[model samples]
Target: MQQCKLPSRQKGFSLIELMVGMTIGLILVAGLALMFANSSQSGNELEKSIRQIENGRYAVELLQEEISLAGYYAEIPLHGIAYSSPAACETSALGFSLTTLPMPIMGIAASNVSEICLTDRLANSPAFVIHRLSAEGAPSNPASAALGTTYVQSSRCSADGVPFKAATAGSASAFDLKAIDCATTNPQIRRYVSRVYYLASCSECGSVSDGIPTLKMAELRGTTMVVAPLVEGIENMVLEYGFDTNADGQPDVFQTNLSTTAGADKWDNVVAVRLHLLARTIDRSADYSDSSKTYQLGAASTVSGDASGFKRRVYTSTVRIVNEAGRRETVSYKPASSP
Candidate 1:
């Protein structure tokens, strides 16, 4: 018993071995952490790219939707309306009068009209206005119409008004145009639509300089123009209008400014519009490089140097003025006279 047992033979690792193992474990953990960080960074970059693309597409689509409705006054667009040049910041009754009703679309190449409802418009970007009738059916009769809101009603009967009726008073006499069969008792109305779309240089700096560019709208709400910001990261926008010189609804020439383009001031003859939007990521990406790229936007080209760190892409859309072009689509074959 006293002899007892042999000394316990348990072997322990040396301090060097323990230190080595810990070092390897630390190295593996560090590598994994680095990998995770890179993955997270990539994910962020992808998200930014997707957001940029979405914003660009949405901006283009919104513009197209508004443009399609240009010159759309229900059944009649130019019954007796004359082509008139729109002045900057003109939103009064005189601006929307029947005499100048033919101007459904207007565009400015430079930010010359900076005093318009939108002063934050970006320089070198295009601003355009669209005039149309609301797609929704307004009050059935002028007496039931909303007070202070302008409405346009098309006359199906030639006995009433030749084309349509435009009114704001909530009285029966306001609506002179009637429905088919000269049903003066029952009249359909459409709300007036006026919208100005432009690129604004405002951002979350607290800001649009170090801030992201945004697509903004100055819409005619009641008697005043209400400005609202829409899509973000829209760096710039350029537009060209397709003019129907022969009145056949087909575009014969594309021009930049509707006011000063060659064979100019034909607002009613515009059949199509081509738009180019330059969009960018809201945040600068360290991985992106565009030093060699020069963006071509409509009639203007971007400056060659790209020192801005934000990633950018261009979006283009060509939209036909449905209400303007569709009415001119009638095919008439002229037969030889009684030969």
Candidate 2:
């Protein structure tokens, strides 16, 4: 009955209200997108960092193991055996027989070409060489061994050691222990190892185009020496030798460069080695840059970061040759007793 004049029902939101609501919604969506993008980028960077660390640590351990084994030749003292000259020592691209001159551990200086031990040196980077008996250790001759397997026979146990000719397809299995002479029994017949660790050109791999570097080693494979990649993202390597110059059996001097002629006298005096490695991320950083950063590898070595946008780190270790040091304690200099 009462036709009350009700307020006109609003048909829909006004144009201005609709626009304001749309703008607010857009702003919220934009904020969420920005957060998600940042989180994804951070995750990618973390993954890269972890990969680099793993590779760097693995590479260093590989080198350390080999370096520690340098100069080890069963129980026989390699340094005690003297050759007529360096030529009598078997030589190869990757390795040479350890000589009396202490060639078990050799180095190439970064700056001086004349100080290099390796015939071909990598420019502006130092490298090191190591020689030792294979890690398989001295194994009794197998009934039939693989082509690359190393074996050892030593009289250190019972009778004189057995002597066998170089491994061949035919000779690998057919050695007559009865035919071997008693005087030749002590001969140490084991797989020999000569390895050179260095930074190598990565163009063959995908890294060079991507600005990444690689660590490589030349090791004896059968009768041939082959070079293979050890790790990626390694930028540089620096080495120093610690010498027992005073015959005290303790390191009295540490030097980066040693010449065969001038420093030949001190080569056999090497007791320990210092290793420095520079590692970098494989991918460039989108937000961060590496330019203008100088990394210190050791007391005397420092490398500047490039303009490329990548992160880097330095790894270092000082390793002592137990085989060498253990034998030298007889002549080791004991510090004078202080009252």
Candidate 3:
């Protein structure tokens, strides 16, 4: 009888029990949803950061390549002229001798000549040119002259042959005739190879204008030719020059303005260059305004435009001019007696 009564226990779950079970299930579902949302947000941020880093790295690489080759001339003698010639007095005897006569032509240099002058091939052209002497020695006889006779002529094209005019305050055309004479002994003996630096801004990823993106170039030496895009989302670029004034083998001066001042020389004394770039993301999705958290570019300073709720990133790099011609004293001038 007692066993039969015990068997009459509850056949269905009570309301309290049912409510407890349902609450537990709801909590689990909510936790899973929260985790998925967090994961998705994290993935998006990671992608954006990766893209920013890649763009920055690409820009730095391009700038480094060009800057390092700031004074790149062909290995040939005539082509090795400095971009900026020393003053007539300071010109080295070696440099003066190296500049003798028209390049490559034997017997071109007469004993009367004390120095030589040559224009930079890349000075006013969109690309570089090589104006050089054949070698160092006395002019050979007629037959040898023909064999050793180096002539002043245009070198082969190594880059796109787009015609470009120099940005200097001169009326010279892109293909104007420039001469080199084997005379003059001054620091100005070097050919002044101008550097072209620029910045481009784009709202869309791939939009280009007039075959040129929206970019601004500083110290443009040649024609206003279109520049290739280094990377996407590059907003602005600025340049600074470092001068080794004391010749202590280290940079001493830092300048943002490259233009000449009233009394001070322009960046002509600059032996090394430092480049800085500012890049940003086209689209940001993360809520980056959290006061308790920090990200790249320091604690989010004032958010901008619709980006108040999204992430913002910036990158910077510095590169020295490795191939600077002005730094080459050995090849700057020819010996006095060599002429």
Candidate 4:
């Protein structure tokens, strides 16, 4: 009886073994869906290349810390003294000054504007402008001026500079006619940092329809300039100065068009600052394709269009104008009358 029944057992799955077990379970489910779509496109291209190298090294360390604080005019006196007035701080409404040659950095190349220092260039790309003289306040006084956030200090003879905050609280004769002789004793407040650094199409990570290519700056605050939006796939920003064209302090050539009515004395012989930037990756990369690649920038410029399909990185830096090459090789023209 057992022998007869056993032969009938093969009647269950024999349609060629159910088509080879359904073609090996549909080829192991299409090889696990192509290895989970290539590991989710390599984890979205390593998280968009680590957010484009952390937004291009935080926009090249925030323009190398504002280009080493360009011409930080803190000690105040900038060469020979004889001033009757006007060192002009307190957001000089953008006319900043420590008295010439402290040009403290400036640029414009790439659609070549024409104007140099005080805003208005930045057309197709490249930009700069630093100035400096901030980070040192709190002393306050002059009737506690505080309109746009007061800042002024004078006494000890005074030379001028530090007048903004709605004329140090609306009229002390317009804050001693724009700072410097506040006479409230040795007060000493300070705050005036000019910035600039361009490259915009707007994008702090949203808005402007996310065309993403930010990096913008501006900043002044008092009389108001304020731009903001820093770093976000910073698409481009050339800037090449370098200069010292022979005054010695270092740096020899590198230009990229200067301004303020042409080379404005090569912007105090710049001293150093090459920076290139470029950075990109605001998404868009089916698996990469910088279209034959090019991306030049500093060696006389490049990067024109069709930036492939995202994912880029250039970032460079030369930076060194540390307070104009850390000056003071014996130049103090005054202040010795009281030891």
Candidate 5:
């Protein structure tokens, strides 16, 4: 037999207490969420800024590096080569064959220069062309390299009949030159280079409609100028040419663009080049405004970026044409080695 006894008083949390506790918890959670959201947003903005800086600086470095190699003609002299207009896809219209002197560095509107460059270049921006041969040589046997590839051969033997010859094979006869031996023999072959740098209207198909500008290049692929994208978010490019009026290898005057083809000899005299690049953030920030912003691209031009909603930056660099300018700086007159 068992006797059941129940005499205990039990109490549970009231609805008001439960509701107050939940409200406090909700308020704390809301505050934490807002803080996290703000942190994430700040981090995102910082990432955009870093990307913008990296793109601008990288673009400047690329220009400085490549443009420094502007007039490198292997064993040949930049002063000795003739100037020529570029017919982007023509091999016969190759290096310096048309002009009276060498035009190592020149800038012209992308739309006006060649169709292969850009269909929609940014504001008819000047596409600067850099003429040189590759620092690295192709296979000694030109037959072993790509058939449609362009090549340059500089004659070391004065008796070879020409300073340099540029051509593409199967035109192997064009590479017939002597290598200081004065014998009709194997010629050292170098890849010919003519790179046209410009600012394009768009970088990719997704950005084509909105037109996120990009820095691009049109280089010789066979005889045709083939366009390739280098960096995205490049809005514009400006170049100031420093020409040497005197033969002292120092820049005497600076010009934004040369006058005419008759004065293209000035291009050969380019001792130094000042480059300007405008870079933009790829995305728009809802928290930021890019209203009434102006960017200075050297002494040449000033660009307006009014309410574009995109953050922009300008990068600048000065590169001296080492092969051309460095060569003329020598004081040696070959004073008959002290007998």
Candidate 6:
């Protein structure tokens, strides 16, 4: 009867049915595309963060290595000492001072004036010379000999003792001497020369005049050497002196800058140093600017304005210059019986 004609049951799907099926398929495809896009973005961001962290960590390690070695060969004579010229040399410019002994003990009397120098013998000719001055402080112009006394002429020698000149003609405030008069009767004056060198960033970096930024180590002897780049993004480096004044205990003077005029006296009591470094990222990433997003380092700090879009980070560390001589002397003295 009406049997088969059941209206061919519309052999194919109705337009409405087809439209619904198509819509469902489109939704699934769109969702998959969105997921893939999100995954890719997340991966890129993760990679960028890891890189930044690695850079920062590397910089910190480098600084620690150098700073830990501050006054490495010798101990800081005092916490803080004013860079004032000797009363007799009043007209002379004041200078800061520190002391240290030579790496090798050749039995040379520390008194014998041997120029405090850095042997770049490892490098080519032109080794650096660090002159030990018998002055109260560093003169404004090191070139002027009137400011201080040129005690020793430090020369760069090979393992064989061959002397070499440094490329530049300058002096180093710090030094490594062969010997010091530890038995001196004068308690105020330190027998050993304090070789103090401040490792800081010079005007060379970021300056149109000085090609690229480099790590520089300056010594009281009037020598400056551009060492290898410790880290790329280092913006500024500062060193503070902490002194343990008064035999009673604890350091007293905390000065940001060291004076050439004043020997260790500026911080003669300084037993420790507080080092600070301001570093920035060499490569900036766009993802970091998003306000809604956060990184492992926390809220991203931009350079200057939104335009420059640079990021900066800072780190700090403190180091103590142990008195090797003091330790040794203490070990030698067993609280001698009152005579």
Every model's TM-score? 0.86, 0.76, 0.48, 0.36, 0.86, 0.44
In order, what is each prediction's RMSD in angstroms? Answer: 3.8, 5.6, 15.7, 17.2, 4.3, 14.7
Residue 298 alpha-carbon offset, candidate 6, angstroms:
20
Better of 3 and 6 by TM-score: 3
For candidate 4, the lDDT comes to: 0.63
Model 6 TM-score, 2 decimals: 0.44
- Per-residue accuracy of model 1 over 1-339 as CA lDDT, tens digit each: 377677988999999999999999999999999999999999999999999999999999988888988877666656456656655355665255545563678776574765568757777777887877787544455666778777777778868645666677566577776667776544567788778888788744242255568898888777778888899999877788898877777888887755654453467778899988889989888856788888887765554427667888889899999877887776989888995
Summed backbone clashes in each candidate are 6, 5, 46, 0, 4, 82
Best by lDDT: 1
Give the Cα error of residue 270 in candidate 4, in Å.
7.8
Candidates' C-alpha lDDT: 0.76, 0.64, 0.38, 0.63, 0.75, 0.37
Candidate 6 CA-lDDT value: 0.37
Ranked by lDDT, the better of candidates 3 and 6 is 3
Q: Which is the winner by lDDT between candidate 4 and candidate 6?
A: 4
Off by over 4 Å in 2: 1-10, 77-79, 83-102, 110-122, 137-142, 148-152, 157-189, 206-211, 262-265, 331-339
When summed lDDT is taken over every stretch of 10 residues in candidate 4, the lowest stretch is 81-90
Lowest-scoring 10 consecutive residues by lDDT in candidate 6?
Answer: 120-129
Clash count, predicted structure 3: 46
Q: Write model 4 residue lDDT over 212-308, tens digit each, in one string.
A: 7777776666566667677777777777777764454777777777653434245666767888888988878864677677788798888754645
Tens digits of per-residue lDDT, candidate 6, 238-323, equal 45556554543344665544342345434334455565554544446564543433222112222232333345555667655444
* Model 1 global lDDT (CA atoms, 0 to 1): 0.76
* Deviating ranges (above 4 Å) for candidate 4: 1-11, 14-19, 26-28, 53-61, 64-103, 106-131, 135-184, 191-238, 241-254, 257-263, 269-275, 280-291, 296-299, 302-339
Arrange candidates by lDDT, descending. 1, 5, 2, 4, 3, 6
Itemize residue pairs with steric clashes in candidate 4. Answer: none
Compare candidates 1 and 6 on lDDT and give the better one.
1
Instruction: Give the lDDT of residue 278 in candidate 6.
Output: 49
